[model samples]
Target: MQRYFVTPAGLTETEVVLEGDDARHLATVMRAKAGDPFVACDGEGTEYVAEAAEVSPGRVVGRIVQRRASASEMRWRVTVAQSLPKGDKLETVIQKGTEAGAYAFQPFLSRRTVVQYDDRKEAKRVERWRKIAKEAAEQAHRGRVPEVGAVASWKALLAGFAEYDAVWLCYEEEGRAGVGLKPVLRAFGSSLGEGETPNLLLVVGPEGGFAPEEAEQAIAAGAACVGLGRRILRTETAALVALAAIGYESGEMGG
Candidate 1:
């Protein structure tokens, strides 16, 4: 079934009102009419089976048939804190990252970051990134939209390490750092309760990769600095690989 994310306020006792861009898409793009069925999510883990009851100039109303838990979201929450890369790399990162099951994305300004953003530019970038994430989520059948947050400095990101259960930094220079992500992942899995959820924060550097001192700073902030593998991956590729690994390791992929 087709699915769209809606706000909780848009949902009433027996119906959901689709407005704004969604309405525009349904009215003009999709040509949706009364009696057409579709799924709607509140982006807070609730999914509604609905059928169009009314279609208007600026809105489409759907009467709810059922409400259920969202199965599209991963059991583990993975947040990607990526260093700003040049060009449209961040857009690709947000799009693909959402499909790979990232819960949130934080764009950071690292020592070797090529893209520089002032306050005004950062806000604009964040808005654009968020739109990409939303579209990606819809395409990926995700029940919730991954949040694209404001840009942060490396130091600011490090200070927030305590919020995550597991923090990982993909550093090329960490090959000989004596830390392997496998063991850490195993230990994390072993410590979890029967149905306990994992909260992971993955830190990916920019095109130039993390500076030696920056890697040290991440390590000091309780993040395990581990190598992706022998051949280095691009900034966007690294985060996708890490997120996929986390999903598979956390049993999110399959039995």
Candidate 2:
């Protein structure tokens, strides 16, 4: 069944409405008729099994058949604080990272970041990134879409470190030293109190990687410098590797 993330306005007490692209996909592309079934999510963790009741050119309404809990959300929330890389790599990160169960994304500027920060055009980029997250969430059957935040500076990024229970800096230097990610995650998990779900932050560098001073500042701000493995990864690949490792460790992936 196809799934969609709907707003409050799109859902009602007994029916669900899909507009624009979703509507066209259902009505024209799928050629759905009355009684065709599909899944609907409110993007607040609630899901419904619904059947098409009314299908039109640009709109489709469905009657709710069953409501149930969404089982796809990860128990531990992981936020990726990525330094801006060149071109459209950030878009790939957000899309694949959402599929990999990232709770949110924060793009920041590191000392070695190459992209010129433009405050004027940032809002549009953020909006597009958010849309990518939404579409990715639906495709992955995620209960909710990951949030895409506006770009922040180095200082601003470190100041928000207090919010997470644990922060890891994915550094190639650590990778070369063979400091594995698994052991660090296991240690961090063991230190948490019983029944505590941790909010984790993974800080990744840009194409040129982090400056030595920037890494020092991050370590001072309660971040533990960790490595993915001996093999160095692209800035976009590091977070996904970390997220997959976390999923396996947390039992979300079949061990």
The clash count for each model shown is 0, 0
Residue lDDT tens for model 1, 18-103 = 89888888777888889988888899888899998887658989999999988888888999999998899989999999999999
Off by over 4 Å in 2: 193-195
Query: Candidate 2's residue-wise lDDT over 169-234, tens digit each?
Result: 998898898887889988877787765778999999999888888889999999999988888689
The C-alpha TM-scores of every prediction are 0.95, 0.96
Model 1 reaches what TM-score against the true structure?
A: 0.95
Query: lDDT of each model, Cα atoms only?
Result: 0.87, 0.92
> Best candidate, lDDT-wise?
2
For model 2, state the Cα shift of residue 116 in Å: 2.2
Candidate with maximal TM-score? 2
lDDT of 2: 0.92
